[model samples]
Structures are given as C-alpha cells and as structure tokens.
Target: MAFTLSIPRKRISASPGQIVTALIIALFLAVFLLIPTGTVIYTAFTEKGTGALTAINFIDFFNTELFRRSFFNSVYVAGMSVVWATVIALPLAVLTTRFDFRGSMIIQTLGFIPLIMPPFVGAVAMQLLFGRNGTVNLLLNDWFGFRIPFMEGLNGVIFVQSLHYFPFILINLSASLRNIDRSMEEAAQNLGSSGFRLFRRIVFPLAMPGYLAGASLVFVKVFDDLATPLLLNVKDMLAPQAYLRVTSVGLTDPMGYVIAVILIVVSIFAMWLSAVAMRGKDYSTVQRGGGGLTKRKLTKRESLVAYATVGFILLLVLSPHIGLLLLSFATVWSYSPLPDGYTVAHYTRVFGESSLYIKNTLIYVSLAGLIDVIVGSAIAYLVLRTKLIGRRWLDWAATSALAIPGVVLGIGYLRTFYNIPLPDGTPLATLWVMLVLALAIRRLPYALRACYAALQQVSISLEEAAENLGATKQRTIRRIVLPLMTGGLLAGFVTSFATAAVELSATLMLIQSNSDAPIAYGLYVFMQSPAGRGPGAALGVIAVILVGLCTFLSHYVIERRQKTLGAAK
Candidate 1:
C-alpha cells in the first residue's frame, strides 16, 4: 500500500492515538509522582489541627535527633564506600592494564559478579558470612578463640557497598589504560619513567577522565541506593523511611513524603553534577577498531602474586554463591557449612509450591523490557532528530531519573499513588500500573543508552534517503531504522528485564497486600523467616537461571531472526 508524503510540520493537531499515548505518560507521571507526593507536601505545611499550612514536617526532620543521625549515617557510609571502592579498584585496574599478570582473565570476569546481583542480595550474602553467628564468626571462635565484629552501623554498610560497587571503577580505568597510545607510555619509559614516575607523568593524567567517571558512578549509585542499607539494618536511611510510612503508619504520613521530596532534589543535583564532570567529553579513551587484549608477560614472582590476587578475588566473589548454594540444599537450614549434611528437601519445597515467583518475575520483566525499548527508542529519536521542543529538557529528565534512585522513586510512588482508587472505585490494589511504571523508569537509562548508541550509528543520511524515496515518516522508521536497532533493543531489553526481575527497593515500598510478589520479594521474605534458607536460596538460584535464559533467548530470537532475514535477502 502506497502513502502520501504529507508529514505535517509540528503535528498541527496531535493524532488521537498520539494524544492517548501522551496522556498515558502524563497521567503516569502525574498520578504516580506528582499528585500523591504533592498531597503530602501540601499537607506538610497544613496545621496539625486545622490541617492547614505549617513548617512541622521539615522542622520535624531537621530537629529530630533520630532523623538527623540517619541523614549523617547515609552520608558517612556512602562516602566511605565510594572512597574505599576507588582505592581498591584503581590498583587492580592499573595492574591488569600496565603489568603482565597471570589469571587476568579470571580476575576481570569475577570483578563484575557484584554487578549482576541486586544490591540487597549482596548485603544478605555478606551478612551470612560476617554477621553474628555467621560462618566466619563460628569458625573464628572455634579455632582462634576470637570473633571479629564486622556487621552493623556505618562501618559494615560502607565496607560491603564499596566491595560491591568497585567494578565500575576498575573496568572504566582498565579500558582507559588500554586506550592510552602505547607510544606515549614507551616515550615516558625511555625518558627515565618507571613505576611511580611513569604513573605520575603519563598514565595518571590520561586516566583521570575514566577515573572520574567510575568515581561518579560509585558515588551516585551508593548515595541513592536503599537496598544495601535496608538489608544490613542501617538505621535512618531514606528507603526505610518510605517503607515505615506505608507499613507502620499509612499513606497519610507526611514525614515519608517530605523525605521523598528531599531525596528527589538531592538525587537530581548529584546526577546533574556527575553528568557534567564525567561526560564533559566522549568516554572511549582507547581507540576503537584496535587490537585485542594485549598481554604483558610477567616475571616469575609477579606471576605468582597475580595468581594469588586472582584466587582472592574469586573467593570473595564466589563465597556468597557457595553459601547460598549450600543453604538451598539444607534440610535443617541456617546451620551453615554444608547445611550439616545436604538434603534435596529445599529443592523439593522450592520446585513445588514456591515456583510461582519465577513466573511472576518473568512476566513483569518482559513487559518492562518492551516498554523500555519502545519508549526509550522513541525518546532517543526525538532527542537526536527533528529538533523536538524541549529535547534538551527531555534528555535531561530521562537521564536524571537514573540519579533519582529506585528506592526514592518507589517512595515517590508510595507517597503518590498507593491505595488510590482505580477504575470505578473497584479497590484496585498493588502490582498495578504504578508498580510497572516504577520498574520502567528505573531501567530506562539502559534502554536510553542502547537506543542513543544505536541511533548514532544510523546516520541521518539513511533516513534522508528513505525520505527522498517517498517513504512515509512512520513507514521509514519502521522499514529502515527499527530493523537496524535490534541489537540495541535486545541489549536494552535484557538489561531492563533482568533488573525488573530482581528488583527489591521500590517493589518493597509499593507492593500491595495479598499481591503476587516477584522473586526478589519472595527471597527477602524467606530470608527473614524460619524457612528462610531453602526458599531464599532456591528462589535466588531460580532468578539467576531465568535471567540467563532470558538473555540467551533474546539474543537467539531477535538477532537470529535479523540474521536469517539478511541471509535470505
């Protein structure tokens, strides 16, 4: 079917469908973020008796010792985490890139294990190994007649979060190191530069941009996260406030709403600054289309040390997985160390009735992926092409959400949309549109990056060529652009989908009573219960397998289809 090239300028009258789409997005933002939160803010100033304006809420937080302490702890712990993560990751990245080392492959791969786990899960695993009555505690007390205090308060939170988030710093710096022109390093070396001198002169300055990016990511992620703090029982964190408001009191708690608003402001500011500092220039320090990973042959002693370092890193990375795996097979559970002899009982329990969570996780993730890829692709196109109005603002708004943190958004939703009437006052509950919207928004950054990167590769001339050939606007996008973007779409889809499946922070805040909770929720619940060992471990294992399967299927289905089509053509 042929169509006319009458694409109207500025969409003189927005199409009914477009209007509906715009209304939906607007409605989501308004209802989920604006209205509910706005209500709380409005009520915050209102008199306690007359329910009118007052400074009570702000004064309450600023004045109260508890709230103030929590605020300080949030800062103290997150700051320490970022600093330590940088300190540890920098040397590792430097070693991997600069010096020849054995087992570099294993080290590089295991460094990223933390990235795959949800933030809270890391805390849970850490607790199992280091908390009171933990595996290490028991072993130390029995053998060494001493037990180390490694959990609770600022110290523990900072230690675990830093360990979990250091990969961002390491990978970023490693790439930067590999990118520096070999000749640059060679010239410095020939000019009496080695080790500390070489570092001070050439590598350090060149790697600054990458270091900054890694550091920025660490800071933003640690500052905004709620999962690790909540799991570790860190008092006075923003996420717990959100949880307390809805759980202990009700949606009417203005205190929670106030915290949510403050968090949003802080997050937005942090994100803006990070973007300016880290992304002032392009990120690819190493030239593209370059040779594969360069190997430097190490001396015998250095090679031995490198192997030792690899073993240490791998042990740290795999400890929790091993602990969880043992827990999964336990009949008695919680006894630690092989579960006092394994049984298939937990597997039976998990594979029996508790399997529902796996299904729920998969469904929620799939829908979120679709939303992310489609909406993100459209947003990317508008920002990159056609010079849409508020394109800059739109770009900022979309990316800025990443800064807002999942827990904050979850609070924003709880404060805004919790218990609101849905369709004919039917008493519609949680797992509604709001929950899904939170997931979509939380994961939108990945989709946006995928689309933005893909769009850059798709030159405007290709679209122009289609336009010149008399293709309709929609048709041109459908026939030309969408097909080329399957890789990015798939990548975005897998990321969003995986995160949604394992989501904890916002889900905990907003999930309703009697709702069919996702796997993360299931795991959290089990971890706290008498039956925690089997269910938590089983569910977590299921989640990992499903995420892997989703990635495989996405690659197999979408990319494979594209390939077959290309071959046929």
Candidate 2:
C-alpha cells in the first residue's frame, strides 16, 4: 500500500539521428512538394490584379465557352479512354491467365512494351501508323477501299492514350486473376455456372480491387496528360489549355492556375473514389499456399483463335516502335505506306549538331536518379525502421507527387521560382538545376515505391543484430541494410533515369533556352518542324535504346539478387 504511488514512465524517444532524418524529410517535402503545390492553389484563388481571394477565376473558367469545352472534353476523353482500356485489358488478362496457351509469356511481355515509350514520343510514331495517310490507313484503303479515323481529332487522343495505358489494367488484372481462390470458381461451376456467367458473377467481382485501381490511375493520367494531347494537336483539353494559358498569357494568368487546381482535384477525387469503392469489402481469399485458379488447356480451335487474337493485338501495340525505327532512317515518309528513301543522315545530324541534347540528358537524368535513390532510401528507412511519429506522412507526401500533373508542377515552379535569383544573378527559373529538380520531383514516386518495396522485404532482425553488436544506426544502415537494398536502389535509379529522360510537360515549361533543353524538349522542338522529323525520330530511337538497355539491366540485377537470396536460404 505504501509503494503503490508509482509514476508511469514516458516512452523512450526517437534517436537523435532519427529525429534529424525526420526533420530533413519534412523540410524536403515542404520545400519541394507542399510549397509549390500551395503556390498553385494560392494563385488559383487570388484575384489576378489585386492579390485578394475571389471566385472570379473559377467563375470565368465556367463562363468561358472554350474553357468549358476544354473541361468537358477532358472528362469525355478520360472516360472513353478508361472504358476502351478496360475493354482491351480485361480480355487480354483473361486469355493469358485463365487459359494455357503457347506464347503467353510473349503476350505478357508485349503488354509491358508500351510503358517503355513515353506517350508523347509514341504519339508522333502512332500518327505515322494510324494517321489519315499512314500505314494502317493505306492498307485499309487497298484492302477494303476505306479508312477508319482512328487518329482523328479527339478520337486520336483517346486511341493513343488507351493503347499507352491499357497495360496498367492488364498487369493489375492479371495479378488479381492469379491470386483468386480456385475453390470459389469450382463452387460456382458446381452450381451450373460456366463461361461468361462464371466470370461475370464470381471471378470479375473478386478482381474488382485491381481493376478499379488500374482504372483510376488511367483516368487520372489521361486527365492530366499534356504531352499526348499537345503532340496529337488536340488542344481542347484541360491539360493543354493550362499549358497554353501559362505560356501565352504569362504566369499571372489566373485561368491557368484555375485549370491546374481542377486537374489536381479530379485526380485526387478519382483516387479517393477507387479507395472508397474497395473499402469494407473483403476480397481476400483463405488459401495460403495452395493452388490458385485452375488454368484450362485450350482446344485446337481455341488455341488458334487465341494466338491469332493476341498476335493481332501485339502487332498494334508494337506498331509505335516499328514506326519510330522506320521514321528515323527515312529520307521522306509522307503520304506512303513505307519510307521513300532510307539513310543514316538523320542519326549523323542528331549526333553532329544536337549532340548537346544527349550530353544534357546524361548529366541531368543521372543526377536526378542519384538524388532519387538517396531520398527514397532515407524515406523508406524512416517509415519502415524508426518509431518516429508522422513518418508515414513523408511517404504519403512523396507518393502524392504521382497525382500532380507534370504541367501543373511546371507551372507551379515557373510561378514560385520566377523571381528568385540564382548565384549567377539569373532567375532560378532559367537554371539547368530547375529542370533537373523538376524531373526528380516528377519521378520520385517511382523510385520511392521501388525502394520501399525492397526495404519491406528486408528482415528487421538484421538491423537489430547490428545495433546489438554496438554499431551506430548510420553505420548499421550503411554496412547492412544498404548492401541488401543495392539491387532495388539500382533498379529505382534506372527507372527514374529512363522515365526522367523522356519527361516533356515540366521540361517544356521550365526550358528557358534551347541550349539547356533535355532530350525530351529537343525531340519536341524537332518534331514541330516537318523537315526535322528525321532527326526527331533518330533522337527518339536513341532514347528507346537507352530505356530498353536500362530495363534489361534492371531485370538482370533483380534476377541475380533473387537467385542469390534463394541460394543463401
């Protein structure tokens, strides 16, 4: 009774290093993510001339017919693109995962090919294949005496976007299909359900989470896409309108900020809807290590039909790459099914006169990738290892960059940093560093996901063991965790570098001088002139090769790491 007055002990605090790291991450996010985004939001609401909050910006956006059309057009195109993407992806996923077919691996590989090419780069090449007088049209005319307007006006934007983004749906749905409990299907079949009925009632509902996730992403991406619409000359969309307003009327244009705000709002709403749709629904299966959905062996007729269907789709998917290659060497390719002449002059010219572009790309993307890995690793450690409060917000903030359109971020940077002077007495907006920073910001989510995934796989006991052996936290991270995550770090770096090298929306806004333009801006400039298409195509080919090589290297590293882990076990 006398000893009952004991005090509760306060929880042990985070280590100093953990505190410091957390502070640094918060500051980094504040400076890089929140401030720029806040700047855009702030500008969107303020009166144009007087700096007072007003609804006139939004009112004007609604009242103007052009702005209204652009807004609705974006919604229309994004909706149609998602629908078409689902139509294309669902059948492909079903064919590949539900049936045993030859070349399934090849089909899956072809699905991923579209991701390697940026939509803008592919937009030009796609036009060569699907345009009015292009290869597909020429073939159609000869075979059936007619041509389809696949690449006409808004239809063109929807078509290119669907092809470029359907892979997201395919990959997600395929994984979902694989993870589904086979017993459910068996039960349904025993009750006389089969074929489309079985899929409609049982399988599809179970895969709803994955399909919704991919569909939401596709909608957000297509809604905020500036490059594809610009490349396809479909300017009656929200993203393109935002870009044109900012560039034409200058940063003080409230309409551009209004559009940016709308873009961000739509993207966030789509993601929230997707999350809410999956909430409170149990899509989980009880099966732990048992067999998954039973794959049916296709009959001879089914096999032939499946192969032919997949083969035709694969041809369309791969057409962009084929078009790029053909255009790169073509001396003249207009109004014909094939290039009139072929030469290496385009390559030589690209190397000879525009060699600076390659150099700039190498330097900027390498630095951006390096920064991404460092930041990504630090974030993963803070969130996964430390008991620090609000650490998860750092991850959330970083990943939220994914929803922010590149054009919006670019406009934010242009407005936010336009007046700040650099050490060289030039505006910060004019520096090459701004371009590098923008690329890093835009691609940070990719790098963060990779690093976070790698870090998650590492056992916490390894770090604890190092700490128990009297090693400092920093030393333990450097000596133990960093080595194990090297493969993931490299993969993240390569992904960041490859994607950043093709970034156009932000680059288009921040590039003040032609001398400082990266490969993406250079390609855009080249493609703007009819005579420069050869050089543009040549530059695009180089970009494709670089990305392809990096992708292969990443795969090799991952496979080797898996093998090493397996052997150690």
Candidate 3:
C-alpha cells in the first residue's frame, strides 16, 4: 500500500555532504540560539534563593509607571509610523511602478538607501537638522527673528523613524501593485468605473496581501526599535527605559525584564503575521506585460506634475542627510548652507579620543558577519530546502528577530543572560557574547536572504545527481551545494559584516566599560560629550569609512562570484 524509500519518483537521492552541512547548521542554531533562549526563559521563571516560579516580577512590571508610559508610547509610535510610512510609500510605489516617471531608477535607488542604513543613523541625522539648536532653527531665528522647536520628543521620533522605515512599504507595495493584473483594472474602467473606484474595488484587494506583509514588517520594525527614541530623547517610549533599568539599574529588577519580554513577544507575533500574510504571494506584476510595466505615458502637462512630485520626494528624503553633513562640519551651531566656520576638529577628537572604537567596530562586524553567513545559510536551508519536521519554526525564530527592536533585544538579552547561573554558580557574562549575539540576531534577515537567493537558483535535480552516484549526502553537499552557494555565501558575509559595523541600539546596551564598545555606540557617546562636536564627527567619519570599505568588499566579492558563475556556465 505504501511506497518504499528505495524507489524514487525521479531518481531521488540525498546530495553528497548534505548530512554534514545540515549538522553544521543544526549545531549553529543549538549553540547561539537554543542555549541563550533557554537560559533567558529559565532565569525569568525561577528566583535565586528559593528556585521557585514567580509571577511577582510580572506583577511588579505592571505596577511600574515607567513601563506603563513606555508601553503606551511604543504602541502609539508604532501605529503613527505605520500610517506615515504608508502615506509616503503608497503614492511613491504607485507612481514609480504603475505609471511612467522621469528619473524612476534614481528615485527607486534613493528609496532603498533608508532601507539599507540602520534607523539610528536616521535619528542622528534628524537631530543635526531639526533639533532645538539645529541648522533649521538657527536660520529661522536669524532670518525670521523666531525659532521653532520642530524636534519635539515623541513627535520627533515618529517623524524621523517613519521616513527611515517607509522604504519597506514603498519597496513591498511596488512589488504588490506591480503584480496586479492590468486586464482586471482595464476591464473595470470599461464598465464605467473611474480611477478611484477601479483601484478601491479591483487593485486594492489584489494588492492586499503584499500590503499586509509590508505593513506587518513595518509594525514589527517600529515596535522593536530602541535607538530612535533614545537619540530623539523621547522619555515616553518603553525600549530604552527598559534597557536602562536593567543595565544602568540592575538585572534582578525583574520589572524591567518583564517589559522587555513583552516587547519581544509583541514584535515576534507581528512578524509571524507578516510571514503568514505574504506566503506564496509575488508582487512584481502590477505592470501589464512581461517586458515592463503597463504604463500610460503622461501628456506634457502631466509630465511636469510628475516631475514636481518626484522633486518633493527627493527633498524630503535628502534634506536630513544633507543637513547632517553640514552640522558635522559646522563650527558654530545653527549655521547656513555653508557653515560660518568649518574645521576638521570633530574628526580629530573622535580618532584621537577613542580610536579603539574603530578597531572594535571592524572586529565585531567581521566576526559577527562570518557567524551570520555560516549560521544564516544553514537556517535558510533548513527552512527552504529540507524535509525536516518543524523546519518552519526555525524560520520563525530567525525571522522573528527581525521583529524584535534592537533596544528590546538588548534589554531582553541583558535581563535574560545576566541572571543565568554559570559554572561555580556565578554570573557568566561579558560584552563579547552580548555583542556577537546582538549583531548576529539582528542581521539574521540578511543571512537568510543570501541562502534564499542561492537555494532558489540550485534546482533539486543537481543535488539529486550528486546523490544518485552513491555519494553520501554530506559529501555530495560539500562538493556540489556548498560550491554552488558560494556567491550567496560571499554576499551574505559582506552584508552581515557591513550591517554589524553600524549596528547601534543593542550594541549600546551590550557594551561594557573597558570591554567592548562598537564605533557606532562610541560615536553616540562622544556626540553628546563635552569635547564638543569635534570627536563625534570624527567617530562618524571613521564609522562611515569602515562601513563603506566593508560594503565595497562585500560588493566586490559578490561581483567576483557572479563572474565565476558566468565562466563556469
């Protein structure tokens, strides 16, 4: 009644080295994730003296006004950011993908910049431009005789965060809108439906899945964020305060840890929703033809309107960065387009006062990146290529990190890891584990992406052939699968390294005095230092260089991999 394992539908066989590859991946998850996660939960439930389970921490957490305010702030900010990102992204996706526009490629690429850079960078840039004594403020006072405090606390966080994260919406929405069948839209119009009606009834529903996925991701991202609120000085939010309560205060303060745990739970839940909503949905077809989008070219006047719209977008996105560059170089605060005085002083202080940060940045980023590539690849394989039971949970765990805010994870790790009893019943803790785990977990999405890209290209037939020749699955994979996925490995390696270099929020909480402090964290500290803007700018420049160099290296590696593929074929 049942088929034997000996028979195959199409000469099925495990690839050589598949077992070893799988084992390596399995071991990775066990070491980095299974151990820490297990430890966190274990400590949370049991008190030290009694070793007894307790809901007392949860009760205390509820009673804390700090946490209560933060919870509300986080929810409000997440919701508002979602709304803001959508308002910006929807129209951009529609115009760029659905209609013909001048400079489309340029704008699209520009949109991606925010996506690539971490959210903290956006917050820092915002402070330089829009702060109380920001460049805009000084100019207004000089020219208009009055200054406006545009960078209000909670409002500022929402403003900068929305802009930085909107690209997720734009990129995903464009993919969704492009996937819609043009025939349906055209048919609706022929039935006397106007643009609004056609979009509402036909286009909207079809794009719903993509929008839901994108929105879910954004919600997760906003909910988990730590740095934006901190740098923006928004006391109302929960993530940073929760982190402070643990690190600056005490780990045994179960109240803060409880709040941190809540943030993690909510973020993970939202991302789970995202993964479910977008399952099996592809969004690149909002256009009519296989060749390109089904765009109706605009008339002369219409073209002008499109140009104007595009210009406004560029302005909103570019101003903060452009302004930050000015702020970095300005000798006096609130200077004009060209600073009244310019000096290399900021650059000097950063390198001179804290040159160690540069080295730390490189080390953490490269090591964490290497970890991400090896581990991420294995996890991706487990989820995508294997028949392993409960592999889906692996995807959830890895991707779930994407939903956890850097700050929340920071506090969670601190609260969770700090309490775990080590050998000799002492607290076994250091910045190394914290930094590595922080970078590795945060960058999990990129690592998975690399594996996903490679696996997509390697058909099972190739893997089967290696197996059919009586190659042990492990050997077959080593000789076939690993080599085939080298490009993805290279790309993944480069990505993890680069992101790790600039990663902040979690890095900040993880950093211990005289142990490990990433360049991004150092930059943040110095930026607020009395040594003035001099050292801070230097740190920023150094960070930019380190990041840029690694970015180039990753791109170079990926490019070489592409060339090798072409040559082999």
Best by lDDT: 2
Q: Estimate each model's TM-score.
A: 0.85, 0.96, 0.84
Best by TM-score: 2
Cα TM-score of candidate 2: 0.96
Mark the 10 consecutive residues where model 1 has the least summed lDDT: 284-293
Q: What's model 2's overall lDDT?
A: 0.89
Per-prediction count of colliding residue pairs? Answer: 7, 0, 22
User: lDDT per prediction?
Assistant: 0.69, 0.89, 0.70
Q: Once superposed on the true structure, which residue ranges of model 3 sit more than 4 Å away at CA?
A: 1-27, 38-51, 138-149, 272-293, 334-338, 379-396, 412-427, 431-434, 460-479, 541-569
lDDT of 1 by residue, 115-234 (tens): 666666656666667776778888888898997877766667776778778888888888777777666667677888877887887777777777767877787677767666766777
Better model by lDDT, 1 or 2?
Answer: 2
Ranking by lDDT: 2, 3, 1
Superposed on all Cα atoms, the candidates' RMSDs to the truth, in angstroms, are 5.8, 1.9, 4.6
Better candidate by TM-score, 1 or 2: 2
Candidate 2 per-residue lDDT over residues 1-569, each given as its tens digit: 36677797755357888888789878977877789889999999999789999998999999999999999999999999999988878878999899987778888988988878887787888888999998889999999999999999999999899988999999999889999999889999999999989999999999898899899989998999898898888898999999999999989889999999999999999999999999999998878842478899999998888888887787877888889899999999988999999999999999999999999999999999998998899899888887777888999999989988999989988888888997878888778898888888889999998899889878999999999999988898889999999989998999899889888889998999999988899889888887988899999999888888888888898888789889989
Q: Which residue pairs collide in model 1, if any? A: 36-416, 45-53, 45-54, 46-52, 46-53, 47-52, 179-286
